[model samples]
Structures are given as C-alpha cells and as structure tokens.
Target: MIQVRIKPGVEDRIRGFFPWVYRPEIISYSKQPKKGDLVVVRDYSGRFLGYGYINPSTNISIRIVSFNKEEPIGEELIRKRLKDALDYRKRLSLDSNAYRLVHSEGDFLPGLIVDVYGEYAVVEFTTYGMRSFKDWVVKALVELLKPKGIYERVSDYVATIEGVEDKGGILYGDVPEEVTIWEHDLKFLVLVPRGQKTGFFLDQRRARRLIRNFVKPGDECLDLFCHTGGFALNMKRAGAKKVTAVDLSEEALKVGKKNASLNQMSDVEWLEANAFDFLRKMHAEGRRFDLVVIDPPSFAKNKASVPSALRGYKELFFRGLHVTKPGGYLVVYSCSFHIRREHLLQTLLEASKDVKRQVRIVGESIQDLDHPWMLQTPNTLYLKGIYAEVL
Candidate 1:
C-alpha cells in the first residue's frame, strides 16, 4: 500500500479520530498515489495513524477507512457498514419503505448516500474513493436487502467536486421513471428519474410531523417551496381545511398533485410558480393563510454566499409574516449549513422588524435523529426550523 506521512504536530487530529486528512497536514508520501488508491497514513515519528482512500486532486487528501492497524479495508468492511446502516433504519421503525438508509459520514460510510423509496433505492457516490467500491457495495446491498430496483443519481456537479469526470447511473436493478412511496400514513408520488435528491427530502420527514401538531381543523395552510407536497399533505391530514402548495418545477407540481390524490386529499391547490413570486402575488391579492410554512431549498452551499442566502431567507420569512393573519402560526426553515440556528433566528428577527410585525417563537426543531451529527463536525447539523405566531 502507498504511505502518507503527516507533518509534525498534525497527527493529533488523526489520533482524535477525525476522518478527513487535509492537504496541509501531509508532510511527505512514500509513493505517488493515484485516486482511489489504498493508503496507509503515519505520523512524522513513523507511528501508524490509519488506512484510507487517497484522492490527490481534492483538498480532502484522504478519507479514512479504518483506524485498526490489523483490520483490512475490503469487501467485508463495506458489508459491515452497509448492514449497520440497514439495522439502524429498522431500529428507528422508520416506515420501512421510504427513508434515508445511509447518510454518508453520519453512518460512518463517508462519501456515500443511499435513500430507499419503497422497493427501490437511489444511491449517490460523491467521491472517487467511494466510486471505486461501488460495485462491491451494490452487490452487498442486493444480497442483503433484495430491493426490487436500485438507481444511481450521480451527476455533473458531483464529478466536478471530486475532480473526476466519471458519472454514475443505474448500476444494478432497473429503476423506473416514477415511483410511489409512503411517509407518516401519506402516500407520495416521486419522479426518481428526474426529481431532486433521490426523489424527496427525507431529512424533513420529522419536521413535517411537527407541523401536524400546529395545524387545526378549518385552518388555511400555505406550503411554500412544497417539493413533492410533503408538508402540504401532512397539513391536510392534520385537519387543515385547505392547502395551497407552491413550487417552481412543473414536474414537482405534477408529483405534488399526484401525492395529494394518492392520499385521497382533494382540497390541495398545486401552483407551478416561483415561491418568492407567488408569495408576493398572494400578498397583493389580499390573501392570507391561517398557517404558513416556508421550507426553501438551501441557498448557499458554502460560507462565501451565506450573506446572500440569509437575505433570501429573510425576504421569504418577511413575506410569510405579512400574509399570515394576526395570531396565525408560521413555520420557517433553513437547510444551509452556513446558516445556523442563531443566524436563522436573528434573520427572522430582522425580517419582523422590517415587516413591522410582532412574532412570538413557539417552537424550534432540527433534522430527525436518523441524521446523526458527529461531535466534532457541526456542519452535519444543518437544518434549522422555527415555529412562530404572529402578534
């Protein structure tokens, strides 16, 4: 195996069990390593650190596979990790058919994501190192779960970030153009072939459940950025009198309508328009809702654009506050890692000031327990939500 030697004093992070080895931490290499090559890492004093897969092109030099000196990184290790992931889902009793089976680093399987929707699963191989083990992993999943279909959703941006041009697609079982799944007693229609991120936002499953608690019978609800209508359906089931769901993607709207129909919910109105534009139009038309839900897509993928993302979030919240009746409830959310709970709350405070509305925060929540956060990695705790009542 190739050897990677760390710079002096940089071995502390490795000893602390951090998975990533940054570029600046490396002092020297015993051999030129290719992408996806198995590498043995050591400290400057020649102490064994860990074993990992090397990616020379990216800033993340090594993604640790094992810290045990005698254990080997092979198909057995992959099978163990995959099995543990499956067991976790089962333990949570997460409706079985539609949920995140594996969440990359959260499950200790760095650079891999597997989302199961009914009898099908969508896999995303984000790094070259993970891509190298794709075939073995797929085989292991097939033997263990025996899902009806498996599909690859890897695309161009994933390749650009990993510094490789290889894009992955359906590698094993056949995946259909569309698939139906269930979440919290509601059936949803998903377009696996073209929908966003494994055909749904499984991370917000718990948050949608929380919305049900706030909705009341005969309440008018608005679900903004209602991709696939998860929140809308939940609100309707919670006894909301009517639901208006808005999104920019016509494809998403189509799925949203179908999902509503699948649940035998006919009181939902699906609108194919930009959420920001639709909110402004609703305000102009003197339309107000008893409960407003704002769950927009992540505006900033990194720190550089966090300010602009905050501005977008502020604008949405400001508009939602305006269209909400006095004493009505508002549920706002931000999925950007750069936007923390503090920043999100502060942004909403500023929005309230600008809109000249007084609001009382009634509740706050984050992603479900399924998406566990590493103690050292705060970025994994990305979702922030607030439930406020207009005053």
Candidate 2:
C-alpha cells in the first residue's frame, strides 16, 4: 500500500467528505506515485483521511472511494457497493427498464457509469484507475443483474485525459445493435453501439412524462435538438396535432422517424437542421408553436468554458422566446453541470428582459429519481429544465 499526505488546511475538507484531492493540495507521497494505484490518504499530521485511487497526472489527482479505515478496497467491497446500488434502484421502482444503474460519485463509485436498457447494460469507465477494476465490475453485474450482455461506451477525450485505451465494444455476453425499451406506454429503439450518451437520455424520463400535463389537444409543438425524438414523441402522444423535431444529425433524424413509426406516430415532421438555425428560420417565417422545448447538448464541459456556454444559452433563450407564441409555454434545459440552476435562471431573466416579455416560471425540474445526486457533489445533479409561460 502507498501513503499520500495532503497540505495543512486541506484535511478539513477531506474530513467533511469531499471526495476529490487536487494535485496542488498534495504535500508528499511515500514514493513516486503511479498513475492508477490505490493509495491511503493522510492529513498533514499523518492522520488517516481516506482510501482512493491516484491519477498523478491530472488536476483532480485523487478520488476517495472509501473513508472508513476498517473497510479496505477489494473485490468484496466492490461487490457490496454494486449490490447496494442495485438495491437502491429496486426501491426507486423507476417504472422503466432503462435507467442509470451506477451514477459515479452518487453511488460512491467514481469514474464509472452503468445504464440498463431492457436485458442489456452499457458500462463506461472514465478514469484510468477505475479501469483496473473492470473484471470485478463485470463479474458483479453478471451475478446481480443477469443481463443478456454488457457493452462499453468510452469517450475519446476522456481516454486521452485519463491515459486509457480509447476503445468501445461488448465486454461480456453478446449485445445487439438495437434494443427496444418501453417507458410509460412509449417504446424507444435504443441504438446502443452508436447512439448518444449510452443509447438515450435516461435522466430526462421525468421531464418527458411531465411535459404531457402542459400540452393541450391539437396544439402545435416544437422539439429542438430532439435527439431520437424523446420529447417529440411525448408531445405527439400528448395529442399535439403537429410535432416538429429538429436536429443537426441526419442519422438521428432517421432514427427519430423510425421511432415515430414504432409508436404509430409517423405524422411527426423530422427536420435535419441545426437547432439555432431552425429556431431563427421559424422566427423569420412567423411560425409559432404552442409548446417549445429547447434541450441542447452541453455547451460547457469544464469551469473554463462556463462564460462562453452561458452566452450560447442566452442566445438560445432569446431565440426560443421569440419563436414561441404569445401565452404559450417554453422549456429550456442546460445539461452541463457547470451551468448551475442559478445560471439558467439568470440567463432566462436576462433574455426575458431583452425580449420585453414578462416571464412567469410555471415549473422547474431536475434529473429523474434514478439519477440520484448527492449534496456533497453538486456536479452529480447536472440536468436542469425551466418551464415558463410567456406573458
């Protein structure tokens, strides 16, 4: 075992259960620290703090997985954590087979993500350290879930940053190219091998279900950045006479059309255009909808990108408001963790002031219950949607 000591004042935060230790906060190591080695963390005075895996090259150098000195990191501990996560989800009764099984730090299993879809599971390891426990993770999942197969989804950028191989494929059993899963009388075809964010945005299940309440029969609806038609299908199913789903990817539009056909909703209009351009076109054409959903991809990935990301969000808000009909509803979402709830609210306020339309907030929503967030790690609560009425 390797020993790691932190700087004088850094021990306070570690005692308070903050899981990350930045490289600058570390004072000394028992030896030259390896990139992905388990280490025993200690305070400046040589007091035990926690046990975690070390990534010496990154800014976030340490991610503590165990704070109890009695409980060491091993196969048994890993199995216990997996079983506990499964137990937690069983209690949620998410009403759908597709849900996040392991939410990284939310489950005290940093650097890993697991999403279940029907009889298959998709796993991702975001850190070089957690990659070492792949065998243990797979074995536990097989024993617990008894899924038909397990697939891996890896990000190229994360792989480069974490010094891991940038490869993705089936890790266990056999996975199909597509899987059909149902959610609240709705069935979605998940393209696990090539779809976005582990086949679907499972976190937005609540919002998809909630949007039905605000819709009226025969109302026109717009779903911008509508990847694979999650919101669009829901809007149409809610009795919207016409639904327009726009996305930049033609591939996604094809899938959306297929999804529409799957639900017998072939009437939905799939448009292959960038969301901003489509919004501008709608405004120019004097086209207005009863409900508009602005759910775009994360504009900011890290703290340094927050300012520019806020600017992008402000532009979307401005366009979304102008494109919405008077007395209609507008829903804007920011999936970036850096874009906090306050940031989204402030952006909406500024956009409203500029558009000269008084905005009335009707409802606010976060990621569904399946994606549990911890107060200690605000980043865990990444998805935020603001529903407002244009007065």
Candidate 3:
C-alpha cells in the first residue's frame, strides 16, 4: 500500500480518530496517489496514523476507515463494519421495518449508505474508494440479512465528484419500484428507485412519531416538503381534522396520496408547489394551522451555501410562525449537516424577533438511534428538528 504523511499539528486530530484528511494537509507522499487508492496515512515524523482510501482530486482527500495499524483496509474490514452496522440496527426499536442500516460515517463506513425497506435493501456509494468494494458490500448484505433484493442507487453529484461512473441499479436480485413499510401503526410507500435519499427519510422516524403528541383531534395541520406524506399521515392518524401536505415534486405528492389512502386517510390535502411560495401565500391569505411542520430538504449542500441556507430558514420560519395559530405547535427541521443546531436556534430567534411571535421550545430531536454518529465526526449527525409552541 502507498504511504502518505501529513503536515505537523495534524497528528493530534488523527490520534483523536478524526477520519478525514484534507488535500492541503499533506506534506509528503511515498508516491503519486491515484483516485480510490488504498494508502496508509502517517504523521510528519513518519508515525503511522490510520488506513484509508485516497481521492487525490477531492478536497476531503483521505477518508480513514481503520484507525488500527494492524487492521488494514480490505474486504474483511468491510464485512466486519457491515456486521457491526446491522448489529446496531437490531438493538434499536423495530417498530419500522424500514430504517437506515448503514449511515455512511456514522457506521464508520464512510462514503457508503445502506437503507433497508422491508425485505429489500438499497445501497449508495458516494465515494470512489467505497465503490471499489461494492462487490464485498453486496455479498456481506446478502450473507448477513439474506434480503430478497439489494439495489444500488448512485447520485449524479457523487459520480462527478468521486470520478466514478454512475452504476446505480439492482446489485442483486429484483427490487420493486415501490415498497410498503410500517412505522408504528401507519403505513408509507417508499419509492426505492426514484425517491429522495434512498427512498425515504428514515432518520426522521422518531420525529414523525413525536409529532403525534402535539396533534389533537380535529386540529388543522400543515406539512411542508411533505415527501410521501410521512408526517401528514401520522397527523391524520392522530385524529387531525384538516392536514395540508405540500411539496414541489408531483411524483412525491402522488406517492403521498397513495400513503394517505393506504392508511385509510382521506382528509389530507396534497398540493404540488414550492413550499416557500406556498407558505408565504398561505400566511398572506390569513391561513392559520393548529400544527405546522416545515421539514425542507437540505438548503445547504456545502459550507459555501450556508449563508443563503440561513436566509431561507429565516424566511420560512417567518412565514411558518405567522401561519401557525396562537399556542399551536410548530416544528422546523434542517437535514443539512452544514446548518448546525445552533444555526437553526439562532435563525428561529431572529425570525421570532422579525415576526413578533414568541415561541417556547417543547422538544428537540436528532437522527434516530439506528443512525448513530460519532462525537469526532459531527457530520454524521445531520438531521435535527426543533418543536416549539408558538405564542
């Protein structure tokens, strides 16, 4: 394996188990590294740091997989990691058959994501290094879980960034377009091939369940970015009178309608429109909801977009606050790791000041236990929700 050494002062972070090594952090290399090259990382003094794969062109150059000098990166390590990830999921509450089985760095398998829907599984290789071990990952999943099928869903951005071909399709067995999965008592339709982020937002399982507590019988509720109506169905099941579900994707809303009908729920009003415009229009029309959930997609994909993301959040909060009835529940979520919890809180405070509406935080939630994040790698803990009572 190629040996790579980092600059001084970077050894401490590696010692602390921080997985990523930036491109600029390197001082010297044993040889010219190629994309997706397995290399041994070392400190400036030539002390062994960790074993990782090198992506020469990317900003995040090396994604460390094994910190142990003895435990090198190989197929055995991949198998062990997948086994551990599955074990962690088994310990979690099995209320939903659909859940995140491997959450990239959260499971210490950086660049790899695996989500299970019923008896089938979906895998995504976001980095060139992880894609090299696709065969091993698929074999491990089949041997461990014995799933009916395993599908590979690679994104266009990942392909371009990692310099890998978009090889997204059924890796093993047959995968259906749609699969029905249960969360608590409510059922949802997961679009495996075409849906967002591995078909469903499995990280928000706890948040969706927690939403039931704030909803009352005959309460008017609004679900923004209501992909497949996960929150909308839950609110209806909780006996909400009128639930308005809004999303930009007509395909998502179509599935949302199916999910609502799957649960025998017909009171939900599904709308295909941009959530921001819809919220502003509703607020202008004097529409007030007893419960409102603004769970938008990641507004910030990178650090550069954070400023605009915060502005978007502020505007959404301003509109969301005004549309929510007095003393009603308002839940705002940010799935972007770039937008920290403090950012969301600060945005909420600023929006409250601008809108002249005070809110008391009633609840807080992060990614589900199945999607465990390490303290060293905060990016794994991407999803966060703040539940507040508007006053």
Q: How many residue pairs clash in all the candidates, one count each?
A: 0, 0, 0
Write candidate 3's Cα lDDT for 240-348 as tens digits: 9999999999999999999888888888999999998998899889999999999999999999999999999999999999998999988999999999999999999
Q: Give the CA lDDT, 0 to 100, for residue 147 in model 1.
A: 89
Candidates by TM-score, descending order: 2, 3, 1
Model 2 lDDT, residue 82, Cα: 88
Worst 10 residues of 3 by lDDT: 159-168
- In Å, residue 149's CA in model 1 sits off its true spot by 1.7
Residue pairs with backbone atoms closer than 3 Å in model 3 (clashes): none
Q: Residue by residue across 332-387, what tens digits does model 2's lDDT show? A: 89899999989999999999999999999999999998788878888899999999
Candidate 1, 64-132: lDDT as tens digits: 878889776889998998998888788886653688888887877778888888888888988889889
TM-scores for the candidates: 0.96, 0.98, 0.98
